[model samples]
Target chain A: MFKELNHLDELSRRKFIQYSAKAMLGVGLASTSNNLWGSQIIGKPTAKSVIYIYLSGGMSHIDTFDPKPGWEQQGPVQTINTNVAGIRVSEYLPSLAKRMDKMAIIRSMTSTQGAHEQGTYFMHTSYEQRGTIKHPGLGAWLNTMSGKTNSTLPGNIRIGGSNNAPGGAGFFDSKYEPLHLGDPNNGLPYIKRHQSISEIEMQERLAIAQMMDLSFHQKYPSKKVQAYSDVYDEATRLMRSEDLQAFDLNKEPQSVRARYGDTKFGKGCLLARRLVEHGVRFVEVTHGGWDTHNDNHELVSNLSNPLDQSVSALLDDLHLRGLLEETLVVIGTEFGRSPKINVNSGRDHHPKVFSCVLAGGGIKGGQVYGASDESGHSVAESPVTVPDFNATIAYSLGLPTDKVVYSPSGRPFQVAHKGQALTGLF
Target chain B: MPLSTPQLRSFVFGLALLAGPLASPAEEMAMEEMQMDAMMDSMQMDAMHGMDETSIELFDAAKAVLNSYCYECHGATKQKGDYRLDQKSTIYSPGESEELPVVPGKPDESALFKRITLDIEHDDVMPPPKKARLKEAEIKAIKDWIAAGAIWTDEDVRSGLPTTYVEIGDEATNALIDKINETRAKAEYNAWGDNSVRVDLSVTDKDKLKEAIIGLKDFGTRLAWIDCSYLELSESFYKNISQYQNLERLHLDNSNVSNEDLKALSDLPKLNYLNLYSTKINDDGIAALAACKSLNKVFLGSTKVTKAGVEKLQAANPELTIIYK
Candidate 1:
């Protein structure tokens, strides 16, 4: 009996140390408990949150933020000076112009990949795809760095129909992947309590499950059993968290909804803000159908109008609420449209030159950091690469972009490769 | 496809006999190992076959829904929130926050499950506010993940297993406010804004706006906006406003500044906006604005500048715009 007691004590001590380490690492012990225990950890920044907005299909810089008014053959580009002096944007973005002081536009972005998939992967993960190894996207990197703050809501959330390229926590393990919303276009489903099941019944059922799991846990002393047990506990906590209120759009005022517009993109933007407001560290909202290979102007006008209104409203709303300063808003595309108009009166995908915008966090706003050439063809000054853009964002958010993490294969990789932060923008 | 009790018994007896011989080692062990491998493979096949067809169908349907609707934004191709759903293991668990996506075996506890089931009044609804809802069956599959112990395994293989920054309560809020104020006082400004100007509007009782401005002031140290639209400002207030010499952008757009005050503002070298828009200012005030050499753009759209006064101001400062319309 004494020997058994000592054995039990040893096991309990091990368990205590394991739990302590997991608490220190700031990650859930249900999944990674086996590997994380007994590991010496490094300290990172505490701004463990991210909000990603992917402007799927390429957003045209020429017709949006970077209007080349002096070009003789400028394509339907009209310039309007913003509140920020010496900063002029396309006339289509009047609402954004009013809030220009909250954003930074990069005009001289250059890339080498023209295809949508490649450019999308490059922009999302800051690494050119080599077909050999898949890399994790920026959101995955943040989730890995910060871990989860709540055991209920997903650590990373991607709203809308689908996620972007290289968005998963590749190599880091499948456990770090995002929780994709099944469908967000129609509306939320089945959140109400069922009339058939009384609250007492629900409580009784939960209690029964807890008791069974606890009994099993007492008999079984394996990581697998513990993982299941912990998951059950987490589920109970999630059911009780008031943070569930973050998903309710009706909670927002009517004036706020009208300000965001009555479009899909607008609603997604509002949801993004709401999620971040609830302390969801990373939330990615995608606005798709941007692939304008033909009839670019018509498509851009149709799609970009809503996007402009929604994004502008989001920025202004965030700024007014003071969330913009801590929340970094990025607007970018896979690549850019061709400088020269094609035979179809549209622009083809051109990776050589493009544009992207950054705002909030510690970035300097209302300033055009780079310049395109006279013909809107190539970079004329301070060419910004995809890595540079992402690096600057990570840097401004106080994330260590240069920190290296090894892959499962023992190969070292930095959050960004060979790219410096755009110090001029900040 | 049901097995007879006698067949099952015989099978167990045969398995025990085979194991008994293997326990002695040597050639029997090798033979038994081969048989065991085959039996194990068959058992796996049988287990797969035994899975409820409805559950299998639901799982496939759920996967299809995820691929069609969610993979675009949260799959291996793209992870908007550093999250992917291509694999089962990447489900939400506590990371930096206390939030987890799906708490397996408890649909009510799983945020993913709840988010999908949330009403319009809840802020954490899944599929987002704009997107379509999952099919009834798809929702059932999400619920299934919770029922299945929220396992992160491909085959439910038991073998693999793999900041409170804001505290609650009134006291905590007050403590947080005090700490925040102290930090704000000590916060450094790097070419953004001057920190010396103590614009104490805390006593105004405007909680949300005050928090916004304070937060902005803390992060964006160099930027300041003094909207004296509704505030009753005295002579000393204007003097204090003018003292922020490091002010890069100022919005006195609809302020009650007179020609005298406009003259006083001309001394501000960095004054970007001298918006005397619905205020008492005439062509003489426009002429006084010519002293501000750094004034690149001005909004005098509804001002009192006559055509001749505008021309006079334009002549003095060709870069400036004196509204006549």
Candidate 2:
């Protein structure tokens, strides 16, 4: 019989997974009960959650998914073979290469938006930036379609997100906006009350605050006011729920922690996995600083090392926990760096063609879809637009991509704009 | 089909000049007149390489309807029941075992038209429940687009026409505005008393269209507004109107405003308002208007446009306000 952690007070920090083995594996097992145990349910969606790893600032395609070893634009970067017979990656990503069977790489990811803000917006919503209306991001759309996984936790969380990140919950109510977290290690703030204050006293104080704002809320009765009330209600629920323990990554074992590396991004990935295990439907962990306009090789080498370890570990860890089948892991960027070397020995933004990786979920692994030309300047075949890429992600979650939801402005917007899902990935 | 708005404008102007020898012209015309003639000649040469104006207009109207009403369900991202309206080949041809959604040259027979026009309570009515209803005019536009052969070519017309300003004497300006007013073209001067004026010929008698054309020349750059709806504006009208550099608002709805005429509007850099409702313009014409940076709004109610045309326009100018209602 599997053991479930009923209370946080009884558990030690190191025994997080040991005592809560049932809590982690049970959710997976219960969710998959509809399918016969060990039987593969073909054509049926398996992903109940998505872990989106956004490598903000463009990551160079040639250095990552579309390697052109003999081409001059590839510079001096060397290619290493992956466990997947025909697949290869940069020498910097040896760990990720070994786990290539878990990944499906799209080498011909293309977009018309070359600028960072526009490209990122395009990638997230499958629509171009416009001044008249704000389109909802995929997280919010998925939340609307699938509802919340954990009653106490917001459906979507963004770790290390910046102000410039694409707008969250755009057309959706503010309640749908991603709960932003600056540091994975710090966990959720303001959850614990002062030592002097008792639980009853805290409840009394909250009730008083609500009573004081009742008149103001009645007078205004606006979306902003309602959103303000929702924040308090949600925060209160989260603080009181035992599931909040998922945010405390210090509960993880040292060996498991070390496998993910010591970098901030690595810790963020660990937190994302924990959150998903705790029933979070969407978690975006952003790792910036990839806009390598100068010292491309040196920076990429440093960046790829942590990414390689963390992502590979994430895949293996998810698979071991039997969570891989239900969790879709996506690694993407706004676009890729140009294949041409510039005066500073770095590449510029290249939106014409790029790459992204999809793993777990229903995605077939050990394969690469689409391809860039010899020089890697353009897509030679299977050019996937930003919307197409987004549609594919939505498809994995079994979300209806065609359902049109109108913004507050009465204009229609879809989950993937006008992009067709690359269903061939399955 | 790839003709720039300027080229189309010049060609139409040249044709107009050929049809009706300038009101006053001699072998040795004045320098300004001669220059205008030369400009028209060059535009005509460019127009020779452009697409058919009528077909382009029809395509634009049909496209706008599909994009606004149908694309959410049948577009690139999603194709409920395996029907896609985003692509031309697919929209015109059925991919599944179901009936064809659109049938070129037969709007009545088209499954798309039938569903859209069905009673709101019907099970097969488009936009079913919770979805926004298709405006009556938008439905008419789609029907007209199909009846016009549903020409679905990959052309963009939002690039816009060019603006050319030429000085005219006060006497000439008064004569033109007066001539327009005689045809019931409500010609009003700007409240600021500037050279600008608004000419509304929406109620003008079509029989006196020739007089209205003669009167428009004098207004020139001062012409701020002109509503020639249902006036059957010919090639000459577009050529003559192209001279208005300060022309900002124009209403040619229900007029013969073909792609050729659309090219003429591009020269007006200051033009922000345009109404091509029920006209013969299409995706190609609107694609040309993409060059007109100042134009942000266009009305194309009851015209021939397809979903592809609407996508093209939106792709070129996300800020553009296209009204089909």
Candidate 3:
């Protein structure tokens, strides 16, 4: 069953990139597809799904993953040993510490962009931010590569919210954009019709709109206009399909929900798990407020506690369900915090060296791929660039990083912008 | 002025020190590394503002080397293995093997570097022994050209560079540029043509962070600048940076930069720009920024920076700026 589905996905992926290229350039999709025959899927896929947990604002690397316990740069936060020998995390992350054996920590994540917007853009798209065009995020790229696993539901979803979240399907069709859920408890909204509008009435209204759109679509032939109809059709399909239940978090047992936690971020992670289980290809759960300029200890403590719980529960749940091997869970941020705590007891953004935790999805856990110096300042060994990190994500999913796909204006762009996958992680 | 042969030898020796400051004395440059240094020396010529008489001689010498050993099989006439040595395009293009022959800005990653510099008895050595071999100087010239972003044209590489490129165009921008040059830090602009800038102090040695900040005071009326990412904190650095008024973007990511430093920024009328990303800024600092009316686009990604302070700041300056995470 999996092989058949994967074969189908491969066929669609070929068509999608071609269709996207042709649609963007107003060229022939078939010819473009022929040219791109050898462009994608260069490796065997290790992951069927991805759960990207973005810790918005920079998390303190010195305080969290690459902690320097007795160093002068060490903050008020203490360190604790994890289940994995020699691995440690912030004292606040008690839950994550216990589950460290299940994770592979990359402590030497580096980037050129330090500001939030640019760094976030770089992190998600594997390209620098430019006013000229919006590059597709990893989720959008994944959706383009593997196609949708669930026909009725969106392949990509963004839970909770952060300013300038890199969730947009930049330059791609709007259908690829993440289905943003501002509140997890709220679930997928506007799925049901109004009480006054009967099913027949809705169908009649859709029929009329479709008839009107058909003539206009033929006359105008605009991709945007076509996307409008596609969105409406998908929405209509979703409203009637039973798969829409995946977005409804209330469907989970109360104990399971509690296990993930009652907080918005916790619920978001839980919802992400359900969506992935239901065949959503990509889900990004964002937890904000890691800036920690002032009151760093108090603020990080609050965020880390929930993060520790939600992420641990998600990993544990995935493992128990035998889904961990197929699911790639990534905990990332724009960058990391400064090693030096400020006068107000806060750390600043440090991109020189940071940390990210990757779990399951063919990753060898209980191992650290890279390290920082004694002061946790620069990358000590195995420096991983932002593109390298994103390339690893692509690698796990068997997405081709070297494949060059032309944008709307005929500019060739790679999946991870020249970043080689950290094959050592697998 | 281009260095003469004697000066070049001394300069090459100097570079060996520059490349391995942390490396031990006994571990000197390998033969391949020495070849790379010669190539790098030639590449640095591209960054020169003008072509001096000696530089012309150097290029001519390199062209001569190419003519003597490489021109017969790979030149414009025969183009053996579809690898043409005459034109820049053929040299840069991948050969029949479908791998890049030369990777710009990195000779170490280039295939040409491996083949040409390989041992004489190696199977992949160029010139095939049937032809004349590449001399030591010729090999260095080729390596240098590839390393220096592989410039093919005679035009000075830095000639058409815009004002926003890393070296900066005018005296006003030079302050930050000169200082960054002093330390091992990297200064970058948003794009090849864009004026918005990002200067990273993280690459520099830890001891130079203070000096790097002191140099940024020369950014003058520039709108955006990123300094102090992962730098060890000093109170003096903050005092120097707060003096600028035309500041649009400031990135003090992950340093010991504090609320007091933020308070200094509040006085700059045009200084609503603050990137306290993962820093020590708190509710008081966010509240304190109320004095500067243009405070918009505060990224409180990690709540530790804002904690419970953003709401009060928002209420006070509803019209100031409202973009939040």
Candidate 4:
């Protein structure tokens, strides 16, 4: 049942590495399956779902979670004391400040990749961009490990038009891929019958497709070839399901809608909360426009409003629904902006250090982990790499970060490559 | 910045790869764990025997290891060659092959033991070549159990519950677990690597949900979380559930539960979380929760509980997260 542990045999470690890649990756994988081991979950599940709020472009560490009030790097945005004693945030994020007790902020996040595409890709996949191979994102890894709690819904639903640098499903099967939703306001497009095709007609089309896929499957019996059939079955089940209303935002009351605000990111956060309650494993809501290369203060402060309002509302909403205990809410970004204001009165890209915040899912909130220097120039203590941060998130969900999952071409990869999870966070 | 020698540059690049306090990634790498999986698997089996006590833990651990290897073909799913190891009664007897799979206190006489200790190349190896062969630690753990009287516990490997704490395998808790599983209410281990079970009675049909909660009484000390969300809970349900002395989290959200139901929960001194969202409970319920000094977080969203009540609760205990709309 566990592929990670079944390689023990007469083959020595050095000899196995020297052996052909296919000999190692595909030799004995088919001998085990979910039916064999997954039914009996030895450990009780924790962090059943993840709502990753990705702030696209670069978020400024000095202007948000980590405020450097006395330094010149601290711009016009004043630092305000949070509800938690000694913790402070940007004045623009007053709402988030009042709810800081529920957050554990990490101030010393560093990454190697600096460019937008590479930085975003590294943050999402925990691997540096390589032209030879695309890496699977965290959502794909979670889907592969623990199939979603709700079988009728898709395992992962990504709600923004963010960059595809996360590399959809990597070398995994298509069934493990995410269902990308373009506009949050649209509420799961093309899900319902078009009002033209009847139910009988839909069934007829599916039967015909299956008949054709049978011959195709016979011709190519590889795992990926058979994954096509799984996708068709999943889509058919989703369309016929009574639980698809989990994606419908119209069900929310006007008061609740207003509380999350009318913005797209706000709408996305609300949609994420709704999907998680219905048992979707992972939901990524991307809020763009943080690329404030020019009017740093004005744009960042403006962006912080929707972020603060929507996230605060999300935390409160999840807690009220009793989902926060098992659902992890993460605020992540590609990297942080420069501590030194640029010639355009804006902060340039700073990949040296940044900040990220996580709450609930067994994390001890009302505390800060790691730290940046006084001027936010470098990681001063508990320097967490990009992989370490991602591994920590995976750890909260009880996933084995070190377990090797071989790519189709025989390259071994992990949820976070060689990353050590910060076990202290829990 | 200093690239003096070719070897020095390569060493610096390698140093950068080792991040955080991970001074030596090579030493801690899973390359050392290629054969350790078999060892760890057997260790986890022993882990279910509970606590720091080693000898008795190894006894249960050995049985658990046997279950891990043999149960897939012989337990609950398929009976390959008419042999089964799932039952405590079946392991000691002979199978369709007319050979004794196990014999009490005699490893040499047992066919199962002989097959596992056979050479890997031999077809008689217990797992065959399809599955990985048992490592030395796993074989020794089993061998030691047979050297002693191989006493099988009636409770081991029976509902797929990991008995992390020894006391959790008591008769009352065992019966409660079976009842919860049979009811389809989703009883599960409270945390990974722990023995305590949390029951979620949040099924459709309010009557069924109520019956499931009230059906089991005296759930012993290991019951951790009880989810009674989205139901018309009766007074009897609350009274019956409050007897779980070690209850930690309770989910009674979006139900028709009243302030009086709050009074019933006072007996649960270890209760940490209470979800009363959308319920009609008022200030009295908040006061009742406040009185349970071990409370960590309480949800009062859309409930009739006034702001004054929440204020009183928070003012009394600053650590509690008083969640409200």
Candidate 5:
């Protein structure tokens, strides 16, 4: 009876495989594969690499870079003058204020996408979301431009946790996709040697797996198979190389760790620095859970502590090591909170006006580029678009704004569409 | 005094020279055509000016009120939704979910202008959580722009604007190429020719040392090494000295070389070793050496090279074996 059941299972498996293959053939997998991998080919920036410090939840401009002291009653937080004369920042960021000479604060950042996902997508891709087309994220774009040199560590890496943004190698081949660390705040995952398996046993298992994979590819030569092979190669390379050292935060001394702070954001920032130090072209460290629609004051207060320490320490460390001139640090959020205090004593989603801070990478620091009204209600002067912000960063890193990448349909789209570099900032 | 007949005739001839030819039948017709063209040009200019005035009026009536009260934080300077009123496309497209800020030929679909017109208690009120709302007249002008197909007739119309394409001159192109070459040399990768110094490692390295060097060069290498003493060895000598399947190492010690050949020496990628003991090399040469990634070892004893240069070199290339006083 058991033999009969096994035979039935084998028959069903064979039938399923045949049906799937026929279905894939009908859908034209060959053409699809070409379009998926070969489309949206963007050139690499002149600057070899980038270090992205994404403040996952929207950081308040009033609380960070652009503080309105005269409107203390209207402003939610108290303001203090920074080292740069006439420039003021919230008291919460005293350390960052001292390093104002290293950054350019964009006070008049305006966006219509108030929600987190939309904002993150807009910021990452520079294209307004069209339901039909999914654009490649900046990291993916960079990966395409600067091809991966090391077979071990991925060209693009995201530390901390899974970012909410759909940060895939959109349009570009999935081979250039970002390799997320999952959660660097927690220790490295799935990297330990199995206790039960001996080295000989492990080697035998690997050989068997490789043999099976090779056989499978020989039979079914598809893009998926190619991707699988690429991943396998990367995994093997990682096992052999110094990539494991990237996850080993303990290698960093207690003093250095303390300087970066013990919080998750702190560790993530430290990890980003380490990854960049080791040759990863684009390393994004996202600290999330900043969506504070209700009880924003309480959330920002708690969140700002780690953010302040980590950001200040990262900037100082990069500057001291003379890496700041080359490395670009951007602190941003989805959108700013509503200036008007709600019934819950919180600020709702206000994308009308916000702030984003940019430092290093050849930017003229200690300068405020725009401003909001006295009541913090609207932009009083030069308003910066998402494209402009991305364009400025790209320009500072030596990526030309007019650099165009083509879609599958031969449509030309710039890396940062419709954005001129804020030449004042540089 | 009265002019003579001959002098008068001479004056007439000079006048004729000044007014070279009289209007022929064809010339008269052409003159009439020119006059018509000038009139048309003036009319078009007037129409354009009128459109500009209308657009400016509409903008002042709409943006001035909204931006003054609502857009201080939300305007072009501080775009909150990745949307800005500074650009017409952003204003029209708005975000992924929302309807257009101003629907052409329909005011009812224009959520942005309507929001401002709503009462303070209403959920769809303009400046919902901000300082103030737009006045009735301000809302009316926005309604008018929407009624007139929400046409952006200003000189700053994003569409159809002539993109000023500046053709790069030969000198500029050459300078750019040199900059890229210098960057690559410092980066330590075998110079892949594009517009820069044409150093084709593919034909030169049959053993694939160039490929190995390219493989090793990544974002990490930029952070790790920072000097060019490793690049002091000549490319001609280093090309023949092959050990690794991927890289060619060269050792040049106590070599007779001036600061002038520094550029040529630092340009080579296969260079791995250099010993400039008791040479005339100075800080200038050290500066040039900073771009050479292949240089892993250097000997700078009893040279004109400064202690500062040596210190910087060591800082940039921690793995480099430096022998100095």
Candidate 6:
């Protein structure tokens, strides 16, 4: 029984599991509930939540945020003013350009890891891919630090990403793991039980399973075992949760849906907006196929349309409901493509210099931070490293990046691993 | 693609064996030792190239110390040594001393940076012998600030914030205001620049929401935005909420707020965004809100608000964006 639930004996049908203990492990195995509580928040946070938009493949900076016009490296892509004076982006982002007053573009993002897997892992966890130990991603750290504001819902969610994606609850408590959602359009798969299986029978099966694995789990007590057991408990609670409507895209009106458009990416954006609106701490929506190694211009232009439309609508909708100030909308990628146009008229992987964007969350708007050279080949001034960029994100959430948490094996690790935040961005 | 008998085993059967789930603890410890050594070497390499502090961070710390301690003497009011540290230009300008106050990239040459670190026994040490001495941390902050280039940051965005409705109210009114402000949502004033007040209650509890909201009627004048979207009972709960003259953005989505409840909001001059999604409010509600000329965006999703009702609102306020579905 929760210490706070004495007054509320009967659970309401609408708002179930508002007490966090019921939302996590304490509900299932009630015995081993001591260490599974969410950490009390420490610092005064700037952003209450974050929407991490991860572009899985390397997005081309020269063709997007950093348009090097008149320089041949820019290729055939035209540039337009971004409403803010002296700032211009690719022609494809006309809608975003008009609302540039709400965004800050970082043009000199550089990274050392060039391959897709390594770079993606590095960006997510802010550390090199080491064989010895896995590191927790930003989501895991966030839940571990402040807990979830919406205690009934999952602490964090990742939409449109691989099931075995990098930056999961690595080496962290399994309760802090993100609920991997494959598509915003689809409901939580297998959330409902079989019609024939009675509730009592399901509870019996779960108890028997817990008893059978009790000894083995106690003997080793590894992160994997904790994660496995906790996942089952999470799903059982989630199945009965009424807030499950947060996942159902159909709840949004058709007009609202049409404004974001028909692409899965657009739906994913709308889902991100809804989840954050419900007080979920962190949400990451991954949009892939950005690795434009061939037919760069056409492929990027096609991709840019959905990205522009959905993000613009998302920004507008958030402002409409007055959520833009506290919700941090971030556009991040593993790395950017090469500046040089290849024989296939496509750009290859280039980790030397790229671009990312930040908006809302107390960030200064209508400004560009750092810059690449005229040809967009290398960082010319104020080069921001991958860890530094992520550190700024942590800073917005009031996360103490200097404080280190020890892994299971007692290895020290910080959120961004000693990366200094760009304080001026605030 | 048929599976063989050997390949047809249940996943539970395979997992029950527990083949040391991803490496045993002993083996992990053994492997981790070698990795730690390699990581130590990398840490040294990083130390050679990594920055201790960025220029902006140094300046932020240094200026904070200056504003806290030195500002009393060498600030807007009084400049004891004919040195004003308020403006960036005045900070760099040479005062009585022949040495420059700040040398940008070279902090060792800057007189301001040097004075704070000078020996207390010396006559020129900052804060003087009679005043409180600077802490080691404060000195370090000053050093780092100068090392990163003493560039000044502009912090003028916090001006023109909303002023309080009552400057000096009665004890009962002030007490009522305090009670209303208990746990009210607030903007991140420190991050935004100043202690400017901006109220937002987008996500609040439904426990005593009725009484608490009725309480807001006393001091609700400060609120421009309030969201009652997901609450269970949002019907005539708008006791005195409609009379809140400064209510700019209001969300009663997925509720039972009626036409009469919205009718009182028709005269608000600054109401910009209103969301009445999934509510029982119909054409009468839209008609009641038609006089809101300042209304810019409105969401009527899943409501009985029809095209004719929307036309009535738009006809009165042409700039109104009616998202009716």
Q: Which candidate number maximizes lDDT?
A: 4
* Candidate 5 per-residue lDDT over residues A144-220, each given as its tens digit: 64344333567788776564356567656666677777667654576555688677886676666565445444543
Model 1 per-residue lDDT at B91: 66
Q: Estimate the lDDT of model 4.
A: 0.72
RMSD of candidate 1 to the truth, in angstroms, is: 22.1
TM per candidate comes to 0.52, 0.53, 0.55, 0.65, 0.56, 0.60
Per-residue error (Å), model 4, residue A341 = 2.4
Q: Put down candidate 2 lDDT per residue, B19-118, tens digits, no spaces.
A: 2464233222323332432333333222222234665677788788889888887999998878899875488666464888889789988989998988
Error of 4 at B97 (Å): 63
Model 2 segments more than 4 A misplaced: A1-44, A215-224, B1-325
- lDDT by residue (A1-426, candidate 3, tens digit) is 223322333235335445643554433332321112211244656676899999989888877777888788686779899998888888988998888888999999998888998888899998888765689898888777545555467888999875347647876666889989999988888778879989999788677656544544554343433454566678887888666778888788898899898899999999999888666879999999998898887898888889989999999877754457668999999899888778888888888999998998879899898889898889999899999999999889877676555444334466787788999889
DockQ for the candidates, in order = 0.02, 0.01, 0.01, 0.09, 0.01, 0.03
The sequence of per-residue lDDT tens digits that candidate 6 reaches over residues A230-292 is: 666767767776677888899899999998999998999999998988778799989899999
lDDT of 6 by residue, B148-181 (tens): 6665653211111111211223355435534544
Report the lDDT tens digits of candidate 1 across residue range B1-325: 1123343233233333323453234334333433432333233332232234444545565566677767777777777656566775476554333567666568887666777788856776667778888878788877875576543333322211111111112333323333434322111111111221212231122333334344434323233333333233345545445555544434343455556666666766676644444455677877787888777655554456577877887888898744333
lDDT digits (tens) for residues A1-426 of candidate 2? 012222222213114432232342221111212111111111234476899999989998898777899787788789999999988888988998988898999999999999989988888878788875577788887776555555577788999969447858876766678988999999988687768989899788677666665654554343433555566788877777766788999989999899999989999999999898766889999988889999898888888888899998899877655467668999999999988888999999999999899999868899999999988899999899888998888878766565444343223456787578889888
What docking tier does model 6 reach? incorrect
Computed on alpha carbons, the lDDT of every model, listed in order, comes to: 0.58, 0.71, 0.69, 0.72, 0.58, 0.71
For residues B224-317, what per-residue lDDT tens digits would candidate 5 score against the true structure? 2222221333454334333222333322333445565555556556566555654677877776667777877666665787888888877877
Candidate 1: where are CA atoms >4 Å away? Answer: A1-48, A130-132, A149-151, A163-165, A173-175, A182-195, A198-236, B1-325
TM-score, candidate number 3:
0.55
Identify the runs in model 5 with alpha carbons over 4 angstroms from their true place: A1-46, A72-76, A198-200, A213-222, A407-412, B1-325
Q: Rank the candidates by TM-score, best first.
A: 4, 6, 5, 3, 2, 1
Q: Tell me how many residue pairs clash in candidate 6.
A: 1
Candidate 4 lDDT, A8-51, residue by residue in tens: 33223223332432352322321123211122232334577899
Clashes (N, CA, C under 3 Å) per candidate? 65, 47, 29, 1, 45, 1
Best DockQ among the predictions, by candidate number: 4
